[model samples]
Target: MIAQTLSQLRQLKLTGMASALQTQQEQPGPYEGLSFAERLQLLVDQENQERQQRKQERLIRTAQFKLKAHAQGIDYQHPRGLQQSQMAALLQCDWIRKAQNLLLTGPCGSGKTYLACALGHQACLKEYSVRYVRLSRLILALTQAKADGSYGKLLKNLASFDLLIIDDWGLEPLKAATRNDLMEIMDDRHDQSATAILSQLPTDQWYQSIGDNTLADAILDRLMHNAHRINLKGESMRKKLNSLTQAEHLG
Candidate 1:
């Protein structure tokens, strides 16, 4: 009777531990009654699976990119310091409420892209949608999309993300079409979602770099307003790294 009750409970699956407690729940006759150790092992395996699934879900929620961070020498332990006000503004911006924007300007390797990427990474972890694209690639895609008649669709898709990181601006001057497309993106996301931009050019030169005094000014107007600007002033990281390597070789 005891065995029957246990078997019936296992079959009915009323208890969560049915796999370990009930012999019939596991296998055919002889094998089913075989070993308690086997059942315990299976329970452990199930627990591990659940834990892994949770970890995967957490990663998905964060929407972080291993690539962008890795390339930028971004490590949690070695974050650079901005002023207290700047840090607070970046972390607790009106973007959380109304979805504004962030503009990062500095010489190369002053951590502009690193900070932009970090903010986008933060938004992703908070479960907000995100997209990170290099300015070169973004312009290329926009140009190609226009040629392919997919321009509107692309903008629509971009409009949906909670945050966008446009990295590596000022590497090259923009053409008229590219400038127009950039304005469209700024227009669409303005007051709707946040944008994080990393630019090597200063604000004053943006008009010339963007290739139109009027359009460039318009873009800046939309971007600079209600946005937090972080100006990173430091020596070139590339030159610093090269000097270090050269010194090591000599030693």
Candidate 2:
């Protein structure tokens, strides 16, 4: 019943709004059947809680996709959504289960970040812990920690998320110190925890983009040495959205 209601709500595109509250307000009674007031209280308790959970899920997914959109400079529809088949094997089918990383690369709007976040989401759904952060913000945070004598404190927390995402790699050149911080995280995650990286630059061009040969080499050696690489190929999602809007206008 829960699944059916969720499906119906999603189909009507009302999952993100407050209009569906009424439908969920009076949940079906249990096997023992309750009095009118009990049922009403149950509705208030169950429906409201479920609605909030759905809302939280939407927010989490939106945050994840937004990171991808920013990374690719495109919208969520870019890559036209990750076909379940493309990732079916990685999460469900269980392709090599090691501490290896997953790298997604493609042109702007190709869904690099979306794929990365989706993979992370899948991992969490499968009971693996996850953390999402943009590459630029990560660097900035590391820089601040270094200045305020809290580098270890920050890294200790980072070491915990079962799946860590380093999104939008190569958005800007990495300084020597920032490059080291990136390397440390990659090194620590190597054979220790899972990592997913989303980037516009291809693997071969990463060295040039990172601006540190030795550090880049170390990062790749640890991250790519045992990684699953997914290369997305498609037109820009922004262009596609624009075409759809134009079509609607013309129609």
Candidate 3:
């Protein structure tokens, strides 16, 4: 009867429950004393746990994060201006639910991208969809999408993600077409979805990079509205890591 039940569970795609039941049969000493209701509850709990794990894996896989980072991996020990309390609040993902934004700014190699990716990983763990794209590549892709006549479709797809991470922001000047495309993307997400912008340039210089008075104001207005800002200040994390590696080799 147990074998038949296991077969039926496999057929029904309750693999977690099936596996748990098999374990119960193989090692019945622990479960033998339990009531039928208690055993059934165990099976259900196992299935729920397996489902949650699968969902988290799927979210992380689809995120396409640049770094294998997580909330726990953040370096608070460094003097990077990162507040643990602030990060704790952000990790709760309330800002994402409220369709707010996050701005990460620092000098090159100061771990802005790493911190952004870490937060993004936390969002995925909470089952939120995420996408990481460099600003220049995003602009190039948007231009190609326009030529291929999928611009609107692409915009819709971009707007649907729970969190959109734009890295290397303000790296170069934006032309008229690029500015318009950015406006479209930002307008679609404004008050509808969350965005994370990682940049080496300070927030104040973002205006100069945009180069168009009217469009820059419009873009920054949408992006900065209710945005949480993190300005990391420290020696380059990359350089520090490289130095440590060299020291280890010498030792």
Candidate 4:
């Protein structure tokens, strides 16, 4: 009878509940005194927890973040101008729910990408869909999408994510086509979805890097307005870590 019930639970796709039932059958002593209603509630709670875990895993896999970072793993001791209170607020993901943007700017190797990825990870935990892509690659992909006649579809897909992270912003001058593509993306996400940009270049230099006053104004207006800014300042974290590793080897 127990085997048949377990089989039925599996067939019904209540795998978590099925596993819990099997455990209960194997070690009945723990739950022997509980009422049927209480035991059933435990099974339901396990099923809900398992479903939530699977969803979080799927969301993280789809995010494709460059670094495997978590909000809890952020190195606040790195002296990169990261404030604990600010990060705490960001981790709550209220900004994402409100459709706000984030800007992270700093010198190269100052942990900008890591911080962005950490926030992306946190957003995933909060059940928000996220995607991380470098600006150069995004532009290339947009150009390819245009050639392959999927430009509109691509735009819609890009705009669909709850959090869109663009790294390596303002690395080079943007061509006219790239500017227009960026315009389309920013316009679609404007006031509707959240975006996070990681850049080595400061925000002030972004206009010159874009090379078009009109397009820069439009793009910056959408991204910069109501955006949370984090300007990091410190020595290159990469080099610092390498030095520490070398010192440890010497010791």
Scored by lDDT, the top model is 4
Number of clashing residue pairs, candidate 4? 0
lDDT of 3 by residue, 202-235 (tens): 9999999999999999999999978999998988
Clashes of each: 2, 0, 0, 0
lDDT of 4 by residue, 1-251 (tens): 98999999999999999999998999999999999999999899989999998999999999999999988788889988999999999999999999999999999989999889999999998899999999988998998998999999999999999999999999888999999999999999999999998889999999898899999999999999989999999898998777756568899
lDDT value, candidate 2, whole model: 0.68
Error of 4 at 165 (Å): 0.2
Give the winner by TM-score: 2 or 3. Answer: 3
Better of 1 and 3 by TM-score: 3
Per-model TM-score, in order, reads 0.67, 0.67, 0.94, 0.96
TM-score, candidate number 2: 0.67
Ranking of models by lDDT: 4, 3, 1, 2
Q: Model 1 clash pairs? A: 62-124, 62-125
RMSD of each: 8.4, 9.2, 1.7, 1.5
Cα lDDT listed for each candidate = 0.70, 0.68, 0.92, 0.93
Q: Which ten-residue region of model 3 has the weakest summed lDDT? A: 239-248
Candidate 4: Cα lDDT at 110: 91
Highest-TM-score candidate: 4
Off by over 4 Å in 1: 1-81, 92-96, 239-251
